[model samples]
Target chain A: MTRRQKRPFVVFGFETTHDALAAEAVLKAADLRVVPIPAPPVLGALCGIAMRIPPESAGRARDLLAAADLDPVTRAEIEDF
Target chain B: MTPEDLERAAGDSAVGGVSAYFDHAATSWPKPTGVVDAVVRALTVGGGSPGRAAHRLGLEASREIYAARTACAAFLGARRSKDIIFTRGCTESCNLMLKGLLRAGDRVVVSSMEHNSVARPLAVLARLGVEVVRVAAHENGTMDPASIEAALSAPTRAVVCQHVSNVTGTIQPIAEITRIAHNAGAVVLVDGAQAAGHLDVDLSQLGVDAYAVSGHKGMLGPQGIGLLYLNPELEVDGLLEGGTGGGSETVEMPSSRPDRYEPGTPNTPGILGLGAAVAFLGGEGAAQRDQEQLLTQHLHEGILDIGGYRVSGPAPGSPRGPVVSVVPDSGTPPELAAWLDREHGIACRAGLHCAPWAHETMGTRDTGTCRFGLGYGLTETHVDMLLDALRVYRS
Candidate 1:
């Protein structure tokens, strides 16, 4: 909920809220840490929920999502100041 | 005597407060075990704009809704949660299906025992140039697939039918009806208000294009929420459109499966309560159905033991929903219901029961019938309580 962070994060955006929730379930089950956040304006996904993950876990999360067939609509790197 | 005195007299014990509630057809009482708790929890703990914020509360609310959608889909025998659309109630679900599918000059086939939910909207669609065909139900209150097939002789746009008659409790042969309609290349939509919680409805195997259900009645959930299972193949557009928390920048509503149908802020609390209701169904559904049928049979047999009462619809042993509507030979329907409520502490629905056409079909249009709709938590003791009270009518 803090406005700023010390480290950059990887965000996965979805076209639908349900889809985003599905991805969250998959990543959480794989023992990866992720936070569900409002999709940033830069993603241009309209109104959607996106999952924020540590940059280190992005590869593992992507693998889990691919196997689960939860294709994220947009993937972006949110740089932290 | 005061109404409180009647309550004590009917309780049958020192703890005399429970009246025999026979109005499950209108809405199920004592909403299972978890419905109220879930609703309260949603209001108390589950807060924030779901899918519209990055906060933990917002994410949790969205998760609960998504979980509910999955559970509801499974309960209704649907394959994908994306296909399930939540509406205000069954009436709204019916309105959406009718408005979204039919066009001018298209024909829709319906039954004689339909509730106003279907008949009323079809009447408006009829005025708009849709050819409405009525399939006559047999006097026993069951629909004959042959009659439905006959109505489908001409090319029809849709066949709208009820899975169970709300007034008569006669379960229709929906699978057969759907097959008949599909053979004629017509879409099938069912009024599942009385059937969803009362019977085993497997939508995947049933193969109907759309089915609408009430959460308050058989599902034992909140009153404002209901469900519609739309076949993924059906291409009806959203009946009403607004913010769906998806694709907001688009000039139109989101093209997502259910979001296309659901607009504006979702009913998170009601939807969560409905979720808890269906989850209860997963374990207790068969037991609930069995208990309801047993009590219904007891009431039916007891009414016949008294000389002046006539039970309508299917025969006593016929497999039907858990509803019993009877006409008393000695008194009017309202009079019997009032007497039961005032003295015996039993609650019953009397008169036309909101289906005038169904009453006409049964030849009880004028006198109407005293209806006792059974459900969970009712036992043989309640049936005995009612039967004992009816013995006074012996002449």
Candidate 2:
């Protein structure tokens, strides 16, 4: 039930929505609080969905994803809504 | 062509045989009208290689394929569609997973009721130095998860098991086995060839590293297309490498999901057909499974009443799929199958059913067993006809 934060937050975009959804499942399973949100127009997301993570948890989220062997192509911070 | 036209054409075909089909386990018959329509549309209209370009047709094909992937992912309880990779069929999917995941000298545990798809690959792997241990199922063809735990005497790399036995219709306790395997630091792979679309399969809840399914079996799809769902975190080498349409600049295969494993041109029409079939199943799957279970339970009860004919696997009222295997005390399986077809015009599958080990476990390897696989189209009338034919042979 986490929503996209209006403040600066890191978003991870994958090649496809499926990948993003998959990563979302794993990150949540690992107890990493993240939400799947639409890519900001600035991010040029390849897919429709992207995982939004709090800036503080970005590193841990990436590590958890890497452990599971999923690599996100775009890991950028959304400065605004 | 329209479904009505296709139906008329099928009716017009000169081919004549048994009036009722009871070989759903081999492949579902009389696919949904939408399946044929989608396939036809894919063939006649949606012409282009998906992921090849941004051209109109190419994009359309890509969209269709992706939509199918999404549908399958949702249906199978996968977190995302990208986790599902398309293959030729379940056999190829099994081979890809086994060959790509297991290395020589790795220890893997499997159930004794596995079809040749799993058994053959394990056999080949055994020669390459992989130690394969099979946990025997009960006489009813159900594997006890405790047996899997016991078989893990040695540290294991993986545990391969079927969600449902194709030959026995016994549903395996996958969640318990998956937990046991995970606790042992082993990955779990479930062969859902006969379970998906027929049973309630929630991959996320089941917690398996991989789940393999066939489009032709219970999914109500056409043959020559299968799906292999790999946990995005799991690393598996591509079975084949070629043009994936993307990453054309580099000879190295695109190190990404689907494209990572799916190399070369895909079965566009088949995938679309499967998508249509999946959609159809989504609407009718529950009702179909209930009807099939009721029919199978009835068949099991009738087999018991036939008094001398031995029913394979779990007894009536047990957790079972739509498959039912029967062994007669006097006649051979093939002989009985032939008699049913010639004398009673009832269609069914007979013999080892590609699981010689399962038959051997059931003590029917020498004589094989007649398998009656009920499908969504089969009704109580068909069951009564089958029961009547079976009763005639009882004397």
Candidate 3:
């Protein structure tokens, strides 16, 4: 039997909500799918928000951001339980 | 006070809280009446944006902002108002200083008693080749100025220390530390989150290179306001670059001091509130400080009477501020904190208080102590309530 493939996703952390929102706008304008999510509580409960994107496009997304001279405070892989 | 009466008092109190607020180390409460009035007046009359226009409203807001800068400078003993750069809060101010000053491969010395606001950022800098050296604090949460002096090496760029330990309310010898750091060609950035409103901070005389302060805590202003004092001689970088009020025609951000540090639309309302808070403190701040010290002393003494309870930090009658950390023999810090809130209407902070190094120093890292933080608006009755609550919990 063939197994179904799992969809890959990456999470982006920001230092401020404004930065996260700015990243979201930049990603959407570049025609990439992005979703703003609440910063995970497990990440030390700091302020600000985060974003999730498809893992396959994550590298491209990061490059796009770099080209725009915007840096993500942190990036992490999202695991499904 | 009864729960109903306490709730009513909170509403009428200048801080507009609904219960006892022992979290002044986090942020102060019962702000001076002028704080509320100033915020309201700014929102009503100071309609235009500050530093953006030459109209009456703009000028009014600018005046208010300038007044706040002056008050903060004078309060900190800063010689020039231009040295003060207003930001969101202490966290932002710390980040501004850290990211602005330190490059890769630089060495920074910090105290074991620093808040995570300083610790975490420096840790990140560590990943980028910056050396973060931690100077240890005593069991009482006091850092030895001599230890800091010893930590200094030729490559040491700056030393970051807090003016007071928020967890234990132990005041650091900032004057001596500043002197040592400067002698070694290193600048000092003091985290004044706990000191600005609680004690006299004369930055000019102290001669520290930079001071990061929280407006909401001791300054009795709204949250989202902080100040960073950079000495006139220091050449620092800017963390955020965007639209400053002026110099829009230039392709690159301006290199001027305050404008270079401050970007985006300023928090004009918060600045106005900060001005009023400073003004109100100037009149009655000293008396309030004295009362808080007495209440803290009473609470500290009373806690000593309880069996199986250990008080952290310097002993009572020592030179300390209005903060106390008590560890109970029977239960965890959170348990006692919850019990106090449930049974006695006492509100206290539990856990490491964002200062793990402090807990590690005191050997209380296993279970952080229950912190009793007092501020200018607290009273003897509050102390009695806290003591009675702890006593009942002990039994």
Candidate 4:
């Protein structure tokens, strides 16, 4: 998947409300700018939250969640929504 | 409440006298203007299934709830806002804390003075083979640290203590107890239902593993809302499980801060009210507590002077909360409370106060004393009026 991907996995999906918000907080608190968008049904939940960070910051965002001992559920790569 | 907000709520909020509301321990009445407005706003403008929708309303709900979590974390001195979990009330919070931590054959230390919220849950745990060691308490409603120490002979899972007694309004030595428990390698869980808004407590400084609070009591919020602050350093399990509104890919619950503990749709209005209440209490808590302390002193002194009544908890000038429970010489507590209410428009709680073990500790096992709880809006003059009403009821 990594060999075929051309864009960074900047869009993330969350399973719950607080988790989505917590990620937003963590990213913001670390001075990372992100955007909240609708999670497409294909992401495994209806009307869920997804955030898009900078394509270059994917590695740093993962590091942040790891440092805070936090994670969001894995969902399909977002092509849209 | 701001002047404009108070004016908007005037007709309804002005209907009752703040002096006559002595049930702050049970529930704080006449919620702040901001609190009421927030509750209304959450249902109207802020209405959205938090985390369950991707629309604007859902986003708004998520923002308000996140703000509430931040406010709660700051208020309780928690490091991360996500560590604060909103529950149905303090009882539910305590249940979540207790059930999440304890298992079969684990020893739990508790005070003899515990509200039914903590006591009842521990009872159920005891039935399931959790060993409960309830230490003896002083008649004044204070726990002897030595008694707590004596009971800690066994390896303990957690020590459950109320920060303040609901019956006697006694302020316990929490830091000391936490130290003793930590030294013994047991985590501490505080039932802060009676202490949250009434006392100054820094969860970080106190170093308790967990804290449970009722939004209605001292927090100045409405009923059906509570808060729990868990130390992320401790790996505590959660009781309820369902859709957390985030991780949907797996049948197994995902591990995170609150989503691991809180499932199902939250009480949005109540959480909003709690947030507003926390904001309202921000600068005014210390001043209100000063007044509460003054009135508590008068009530304590006047009751003793009346010659037929004895007050429970710490003596005059000793550290105490704003609660006072008096055991009268001649009458049952219910009659006294009713007479004061019917004749003088005063309000007080009667009957065991749901702390049967507490009642036993204070020598009121069969009949509970009349409990008067002080809070934000009351004054010393109001307390004098209450004292006069008690005298007439006595005569």
Candidate 5:
């Protein structure tokens, strides 16, 4: 039997939505492609926003946020239902 | 409570919501009105890096930074403002003392109620051949001076203790502990994260060798700023070495009091805010402490009245700060915190509160106690709301 392929991941969680937006701005200014996405329901129902970035660039995105002193709660891949 | 009720209860007429901010022990809220103004002024009017230029702006910024150091020195009872070294916060300050002062074979004594910021760094040193001793405390989270005295050995270079337990708010007897450590030929460092703004700290009277304090928590300044006070007689190596505005002759860092410890461009804006906070505290801090004492007393009495809730600490009259911890018989601490937040819009902290050894001593390890930290802006109404919510939870 053939297995279905998984989509590439993007999206990082933050403790505060404001932090997520701030991270997005910093990452974008650093010349990285990024977008602020609403928190995914599957991860958890909590208040905060998430940042969407390319799967390959997730590590770089994390480093940029940390360098800017914005700590994200978690980073996960976006999947289509 | 409804929106209208909240607005009426707070009665600020400036901000909406019941908005009871009680987490001062973590970091203060509603910083004096001047704090925000100071921060904004620094960002707008302030220019030029401190200690770096012959220009007027640089001189002005340097003067502002020096004024902040003077304020900190006055607050902590330091003999000279030059002895106070500004850092990123208490964590960095403690790290500077530890990494800068302690050698590989030296032994250090720290209390069980220390925050991770203190414990973790010392633990790292232990792995690197430094002897780290964990001095035990009483069940109520109070550190015994005698126990600290017994822990000191010939190799012990320093004894570190928190003036107030971040977890339980039990004030340690620092004066006695410092005397004991000093008698044993060991220097003492007090982490005043919880006590600096709440209680009066006279460094000369207490006789501690060093003190690390946070600017954001008790001092009501922006984060990323802290003060470290070193005794004039004692000297520690510089943690980071870079450009000092003066003494560019040698590539090595200057061997001065503050410049010896501080290197590179400092957090000028945060330090400016800290200066304003110190001024604000000097003027209105006593009133705020009185308010916090009243609130904490009410909280302690109310928690005792609530059945099955065991409050931690010595009796009511004993020396304690504004923080109170209560362990409910039926519910976990996090559950109570969440319930208090969602049901009554009450904000509080729960869990181990970053002092695991304190909890282990108190036997509240598995289930941490719910902590109600009273601050400057809290009122009796907020205390009443918290008590009512806890009562509902107990029932």
Candidate 6:
């Protein structure tokens, strides 16, 4: 049995809310363009609030958040809400 | 709380929807949206045990814990985030600092308004050859710095004082006390349990050697998480020693800032919630504290207007924290509190509030006192409801 592929939208799940907020602030400042959505429930607990970015801006958003030392996003991704 | 929220929270009819929570001293309720979500996230998505290993989950958990430390450090105005150590709660933090720092034949100065958290530990130490001197508190629950200075006559090793009185909401002048203690070459350990989110506390400015706070009280975080700010210059032995993610190679506990203190697995979810709560409180604490002050004054004036009632703690306009203790002439505090809960759905504490020393100082040791600790999101409606309840009870 083969598993289905995740959607094109990249969601960054944070370990804590402050980390998500920090990422949100940096992404907005850098004009990377991301929207916050409830976690898709696939990932484990404590990262329920995640930042969703378009596939095009995922790289830039990741860069901005990384620069702030807020690498809260996990390796997981989801397609939609 | 909204009607929908109340309906959801009142799932159990026996509990009777708590219309208002005036027990911020015990633990704050209706935490920020981020706090609840943070806890949920940790349980569901972030399941790593922090400081245990370098695995993915462990690393993520460690990041969350470190973020909490940084938040607490910024909240307390510490020089660096590394100085903050996480504990079970303010009570444990107090025990760690007092038990680890004090030795036999050491003389310690404590305020009469201290909670049992500080008083009991000192009491046990007293039997073990530790000299404990208590500076009496004024009727209004304020500790006179002059009395503390006079008591400092004998050489003391340390001074333990609460930044705010949990029973009476009395705000002590800690900066002055810290200065006096430091002048006599004594280290100061401030119990900031009731003061952290209620007042502006800057460790560097206060110049205290150690400060401890409960994250769930004024900080609007989940319980089971406490913060301890130890000035790096001060050397206090660790109360507990076990597995600290680092320094496993050495048979002895590693001499480090936090690793030396934090042993065993920590409450990662609680710490994450605290980090989120502190972040939510970022830069807006002064405004929130000011609002609570206004509410406190409003409650004080309202209670006074309800004839035959006497309110304790600092007067209406005086500099104070958000807690208020009331003594009605007609009924006992527990009776009034029960009526408030059963009849009016109001929640409050009616007892010594774990600060028997404070009640003793206030001369209400026998009857105890009904304490209303106001916190975030408490509006005039709740205050009015409480006032109306008190008036009805009197009638």
Two-way DockQ contest, 1 vs 4, winner: 1
Over the stretch A1-81, how does candidate 3's per-residue lDDT look in tens digits?
787665657878754333454576679888898876545544432423567898888998999888865677678787531
lDDT head-to-head 1 vs 5, winner: 1
DockQ scores of the candidates: 0.67, 0.06, 0.01, 0.45, 0.01, 0.04
TM-score of chain B of 2: 0.96
Model 6 Cα lDDT, one tens digit per residue, B226-335: 88888888888888888765434456875756777887888989999999989878855456778898999999989888877778888888878899898889989999
Whole-model Cα lDDT of every candidate shown, in order: 0.84, 0.84, 0.79, 0.83, 0.78, 0.82
In model 3 chain B, the worst 10-residue window by lDDT is B10-19
**Candidate 4 residues B1-395, lDDT tens each?**
55344334322345553236787888886688789899999989889988777678888898899999899899889988888989999999999899989998999999999999999999999999999999988988888888898889989989999999999988888899999999999999999999999887799899999999999988999899998988887777788788877656667776877888888889999999999989878875557767778888888899888768878889898878889998788888898888777777677799899999999998889878899988866666668888888887678
Candidate 2 TM-score, C-alpha based: 0.83
lDDT of 3 by residue, B1-395 (tens): 33344345544555333346677877776566688888888889786676555445655566577678878778778876778899999998898889889989899999999889899889888998899999899889889988998898556999999998888889999989988998898999989898888888888778888899999987889888999999999878888888754445455765755677787778988988998888877886667777878888888888887767888999889978778888898999999988876676566789998888888888999999898888856767677767777788888
lDDT of 2 by residue, B18-97 (tens): 46778889998767778889989998899887765545676677768888998999999998678899999999899988
Instruction: Give the runs in model 5 whose Cα sits over 4 Å from its true position.
Output: A1-81, B1-18
Evaluated with TM-score, which candidate comes out highest?
1
Candidate number with the higher TM-score (2 or 6): 2
Candidate 6 ranges beyond 4 A from true positions: A1-81, B1-14, B283-286
lDDT of 6 at A78: 66
On residues A16-72, what C-alpha lDDT tens digit does candidate 1 reach at each position? Answer: 888889898899998888888777877877457888899999999998999987778
**How many backbone collisions does model 3 have?**
2
Q: Which stretches of candidate 3 lie over 4 Å from their true place?
A: A1-81, B1-8, B11-19
- The sequence of per-residue lDDT tens digits that candidate 4 reaches over residues A2-70 is 455444446777655666777888999989976677776666665568877776777798789768756
Model 4 interface RMSD, in angstroms? 2.6
